[model samples]
Target chain A: MTELYQKQRAMRAMRKAAMQRGVIAVLDVGTTKISCLILRFDGVNLNDEGEGVGSISGHSGFSVIGSATTASRGVGFGEVLSMRESERAIRTALQSAQKLANIRVDHVIACFSGGKPRSYGLAGETTVQNQVVAEQDIARVLSACDVPDYGDGREVLHAQPVNFALDDRSGLADPRGQLGERISTDVHMLTVDEKVIRDLAHCVKRCDLELAGVASSSYASAVSSLVEDEQELGAACIDIGGGSTGVSVFLKKHMIYCDSVRLGGEHITRDVSMGLQVPIASAERIKTINGGLLATGMDDRDMIEVLGETGDWEHDRRLVSRTELIGIMRPRVEEILEEVRSHLDAAGFEHLPSQQIVLTGGSSLIPGLDGLASRILGQQVRLGRPLRIHRLPQAYSGPTCSSIVGLSLFAAHPQDEWWDFEMQSDGYPTRSLKRAVRWFKENW
Target chain B: MSQINPDRYTRSDPAPSLWSYRLLRLMLSPYLRRMVFYGIPALFLVGVGVINITNEQRREQVLTTYSEMKTFVTERPEFTVNLMSLKGASDSVMQDIREVVPIDFPISKFDLDLDQMRQIILGLGPVKDVDVRVRSSGVLQVDVVERLPAFLWRRDDGLEVLDATGIYVRTVTSRLQYSNLPLIAGEGADTQVAQAKQIFVAAKPLKERLRGLVFIGERRWDVVLDKGQRLMLPEEDPVLALERVIAMDQAEDLLTRSVKAVDFRLQNRPTLQLRSGAMEAFREIKLMQLGQIK
Candidate 1:
């Protein structure tokens, strides 16, 4: 019995050590670009020396050994538009990163950005069989979650037992071996588009990479953007991208719900393109330079030069007041915010303990955007940048890098799944948790 | 002019139809015969329908029962247990449970408890743990985690095993197979079980270094080293106090040479109490040791 117990502990220690040294590859399949980073870890030893002394901590190796990114093709609104083009793009990125790291990368975890995401809070209860809820009972309650029929083409991306309740008692973190009359559990199920999930998986497979896991882009963004306190309490992460805006709600360090709006920075660019009568590329530049939500003191006397595509040098001139630019930018941004508000409302955002809103992405960099968003959101709104990384290239450290940086962290410290619990049936005498009922009786 | 009874008008009553044939003859005509003939068959059909429906329900129940039995036969544990004795436990309680239960095997395989089972068995001097669990179908499962026979502590209430946790495992026979353990007997031994548990947990790293532990007061503990000696420990912050003992082991060849006991019941420094009960040796453990506690 002692030998059996000792062997079990030894195996667990070995598994934890093995995970620290393995190579992990991340695939970020966005509409604009497909980035891949192949990281070779030196194992997770708590006594590593660096500037990352106390800031970013734990077993996900804080060592950055390799990274890579490439422009995306044949992808639209977060799904692969053409399999061949997307496959080629992924191969290019992976090969480029592998070249830099001087290593062969095989396994990959990809983050998806599209799908009409909805949140459902389901709860289930069962009686304690042995006068207590043991580990088996916990597994039973989670399995009894009816295996929600998330349509024919969809697959369950995440099914987590968020909170547990014992009889009339609430706020139980770990209900294992605890006694009560009835044990109830709150399960949060997240589903993704089957076609999208499968196609991305196929793309990775085509690139000769095993699909280790899949996470939502919005969820990955929240990981790097939201701080530890925000994650512990609750916060909404809004990432406005090139072709769409993704919204994710997090509490207790896990994403409870995620959604996306099809309108993004491109819409704002299009609005400027029409208002200033310039090329689409020129409108983007002008928007970056002159876009603002507030235009109170701006003078009509201030003029802006516009470059048209007429090809005649004399005709390539136009002027517009700052007020006109504000008029064009304000409505589109407000429309995007309005759509995001409905998304938050529908996901039951009010149930969260904290109502802080952290906005990220390239579109969030507009001047006076926070005040406008705060007015529209009716909550504390602040621009967010991904935290917890060292010696980050200056060009890659911004709101836009939230998902990529978060992907790095997520790959490093993936949570232990159900199989991590040891349920060995050997020579040791296994005792039932019947006496746990004494706790309830004593408290009553 | 009383209205005829429904039963008297109907053929369901033989008395109304058999003797009063003349009156029934008129009622037995085509119009009346149609009602009588069809009504009887319809009643019979209803009866037959109910019988068939009930038979089908019974068959379904049998099928479900067979399915469950198949699963149990395949999944239930195949345990090897020998029945030692049945004494204090009530046979009627076992009988009432066995009426609906399908344990399918003989009861002689498992040990049965009887008599004042709780007091007697719990009073065992050697046994350490008792765990009991009940299944949903009313089957009781009992597991006993026993301790090695050590010492008999005489207390006012009774004798009990001073386990690693310092709690009473049980108390009964003092003489048993387990040896190489020191014994301590005194008044107020019941209060030392929890302290003993702390000592066992704290001295995990010093496995071979430990010989035996004795209760000094209930709040204090006396630890005997491998060479047959003792160290008295104080109640307050005993962990730090044990660290001091570890330091002495390094400064002096404390664990290497033979000595009786070291008393640290006082906070300042450890005092030695020499009495070579099991091993023979030395003056003061000449300090020079420089090995880790592991």
Candidate 2:
């Protein structure tokens, strides 16, 4: 737990240093594509710097001055499988984007989608030292949370204080300067397998750059895809990417739960290639052009060519009805949606005030996905697009770039983590039993 | 009207119709759908290709014929800023602006940066703010908001006119130009025009004997008189207590007597320093009163 706290503090310090230097790059390392967005800070507006996005300040105002994407190589299921191949791909994307922006950036905030994310909601409370809950008390209460030994091979990725309560009053966003006898806090902690992070850090170091910050791709996706009201009330953003589907639940503009599934669009592509007896490239093209779930009588007559390998002439070309193509794609798409539904159920997503599901990502562009998702997930679903920013290229403004753009937003104005609050070392006890007992009493 | 219920009509379950299903499938079929998606872009590419092949020869043919007309249109005087004009400015400040910002006429308005010209015009001393714009009629319009003179400040260097915000409006070669405004004299008096103005308004009753107000150390005021009397005012609420002094003078004719100076820095004990003759008379009267009492 102390190591986890120290790592969070180190990341915060790096983020502050990177922000003060002005320009930072955001890299979204996905299984299918690696995207880089160079963000010029332009110095924050002094009057309203700390206020969250959707205003004229924060990361939403940053322009994607330089953006370049390359086909990902040596990445499988959103983790780096080969260091050399991934490093080369990262360098190509960063160099081309930096060349376009005409400024070299050394600090980068990277996001990844793998390592099996798990979420926990922990609460702790502390007495108000001076009758009024000051910032120090808030920090002490947050530090006082008993971080259950979340296994040996895992590390904390995001720990956010989602809600605060002062004595009998609950749902307090900020309790400082208020008179209260006790201050209670609920912090949402997301941990991932540590080996995946070490691999990513090594790959980044090989590219001759410093990793200023790290964020979960699922959390970043929700930040970009969900509308302000949807996030404030409560909604789930399911980012269906190439090799994985990321599920994140945001409430009060904070990510309270996040999980990732191993199945994604590439599996469906594999299914199409194997079912239609065609190459993977041809399968990808045909799926993107002609894939859907709902088919009817007229689709039985509509035929599409299954382009084959060039070696054999007679077997090189074949024709299949659109209904057959839908027959192969529908089951797989439904399987993915069902898996997402189960993950949502496991996260207690139904208890949220609003259960609107927003589907975003490259694979989410499949026609009739929202209708199918509604049937399975049983929520008011809508196709999510990244909130429009100034000067963003029309090409990169689609659902595929949601995670990267959200990473850019996260880089500019990170949410207030536990480390942001100032803690007094002299007065704070080092893991006392009385505080743990108090936490259990207040939370349970 | 047959005992209708809205729930029956609004039910989510719609009876599956075969004809609508066939229609939806017809629209959703890949062959027709791909054409619906890629047809426009295919047609656009073909159109662009044909145009590109024909445009080279078309440009060669037409460019030779239209060269003279192109030159004639580009050289038109209406498209250029030929006759420049300045509005809403006095003659002298306008002349100063024109001299500082030298412009070559018969130039294209696209080449002119209006913001730079606005900054140049605003740099003039009396010009508080200015707006430089180009009219569609081809005349350059310069709208000026000149700072008005608020007070006449007499200093060791020279007399100058100060604006309401204590900014120097213009230098006065002679005091007669702004004699109607209240005159202030001292070092740093131009920075305290608002305070000096308040004191002058309070001393309006002593207008005839009032010479001018002198600012002391840029903190307080000294009301000078034509008969060489001075009133030292307190730093805080000087104007209100000056009004009180004016009321006292109106009641007792204090200014007409042998008072050299009045000090009101102390709110409770306002001391009037009398002249030598009055001081000696006061001491003799005090001594005679003491002997009588013994």
Candidate 3:
């Protein structure tokens, strides 16, 4: 509907205004924790120099001056179940970060991994005008693509042209100046539940801050965790969060597919709590201290004390072998991994040239996670940590801060989207569908 | 997929369909979202205002009141430049600068172009740099740095005062005004003021006898004495050569001798051209010494 398009345009305008102001706050509204980062841009334009086409102003430089995190409340499965509690938590994080930065932020770009994200690869093509493609021609081709219904309750979050081909020259990142008879593009579109987005916007409004932009938490995590080579060659970044595990596939520096599994580190902790009848806090401590995927004979002799807060002397002091604790934690972690693998299979991720898997997030911190993921997922797997940021504290340079750091990166240098250009033509649904089907048929 | 709006898809003609599609797509595109959000509401508000303002009497009243408020704020006395002051310049140079960049006072500070005024002031002959600022005391302050005369050069154009960097500052109509400064002359002597200043500093011992310096070929310096003697100095490390010559003069009173010139172009074995009479006497003495040895 035109309403969805209008909302996206409005968000883009807000993002532009915020960027022009040279300072913006990036908020990561995760299930377990909410983080806020304030970035100051140095007003350097990337495209000012002669470089590859993606050198937009976002690729300009920025530095994080303030960052704060708070325990998230009224959030489950990355979705805001209680608006009041989530708003309070977001305010606390933003205020503390603002204090550290010594500047009040009025605009914030938020990222979240909730509302069940769905990815679709849409393709578009147009006959070259004057035997060469202009910016308008590319825009026209993008707008020509069919807007999938994507169900009634879902809304498009990201619609970006991933690849462009001109005549026989395929895999063209940008083809505006090239001479070709026909120009075709493959675009990646991700949609999520509309209600969650509305809730987040409303919450941000209530906090007296403007929602400048929004992104998928999984996509952000992937951008921060995946190495540059892995992204170019093809790789999947599976961000295992506290309440949800995010799976995003990147190829040629573009995310072609993304999905989230409703299970994460919290679920494993819950399983430990239920299996051992220990307190949730104690289970978390035990998980952090003695959690591992592969156990050995030495673990059997190593005992971890699970302190109970029930206030009863009998139940408060109990020691369990590390192997037994690992026994309780492995199945849930395996289940989450199994679900992630199934999503990858459903996405047909094996078709990409590279099958490197990067496992990151707070949950992925479990000792021996990469080994277990590689064994189960059947690909080269590595533990991912957020890339080091300038002046970022050493405490936050871990897998847990991947989403927030990635969100900062996204805010500083956003990938070019479809609406960034002026299209030559307007609205149709069937043209994109036919083009996508043709592309799929030809490629498959 | 179930169609929520099938009527929009029923149009088959490419012309009308494309136009409508383009319009809808443009409106829906996120890039224009803010414009639509604001434009729709603003358009509605403007429409309502236009309908209400259809009465000519009310429109005239609003315009009259707006103009009155604009004039009231712009005419405030505090915003006017009441006084202009110049800083860091001699009174005569300041007066000359004022004549070059004259402005009528009692004007609004906002109406003044500070950068343009600064540029004009810098164009003055003696002004090296200028800074223009408006103080809270309703004064437009101009700070100027006048070029200092480093050396007086006699060029084909006439006598002129040169700054330390060899930039022409002013024409010296009379030499008595700058009698204390060193005098230099050549085709390109103005640009070599720094080197001339160094030579003058090194030749302080013979300052009384020193007349001036002639820059030859824009390279070597010929130190002219008041007694009509010239000391030709080498191009490289002329300071060291001048120091050595000064030391020899202190010990042997070399400048008082009948030597006409000393060539130190070669690092070693300096050659001195003596007066003709002195040269003949030196040759006769050398012949007498040869005859005694025989």
For each candidate, how many residue pairs have backbone atoms clashing (under 3 Å)?
22, 0, 11
Classified by CAPRI criteria, candidate 1 counts as incorrect
What is the C-alpha lDDT profile of model 3 across A1-444, one tens digit per residue? Answer: 456567777877787677777778999999889999988887656444323586443456788888988888878999999997888778778777776876667789999999999998888878887887887778777876777779988888988889998988899888888899888899899999999999999878876688988999999999999999999999999999998999999999999999999999999999999877886866887899889989999999998876665556566677889999889889999999999999999999899899999999999899988888988997589999998877777767899999989988888778877656554554457788889999999999
Model 1 segments more than 4 A misplaced? A1-21, A44-59, A299-302, A312-315, A416-444, B1-294
TM-score of 2: 0.57
DockQ of each: 0.00, 0.01, 0.01
User: Candidate 3 residues B182-262, lDDT tens each?
Assistant: 899988887777888899999888888899999999888889897678888899888889888888888999878888887
Chain B TM-score, one value per candidate, order as shown: 0.39, 0.69, 0.72
Q: What part of the reference interface contacts, as a 0 to 1 fraction, does candidate 2 reproduce?
A: 0.00
Docking class of 3: incorrect
Question: What's the lDDT for candidate 2?
Answer: 0.83
lDDT of 1 by residue, B1-294 (tens): 123233432232111222232333334345556667798789889987677567978768777998888766645454322222222324542332233232443332223342234334445433344444433343445444455434445455555555554455455454242344334445554566555556656766566767656665556666666655566778776666776777778788765654566667778866766555422222222221322222
lDDT for residue A433 in candidate 1, whole number 0-100 = 44
Report how far off residue A414 is in candidate 3 (Å): 0.7
Model 1: lDDT to the true structure: 0.66
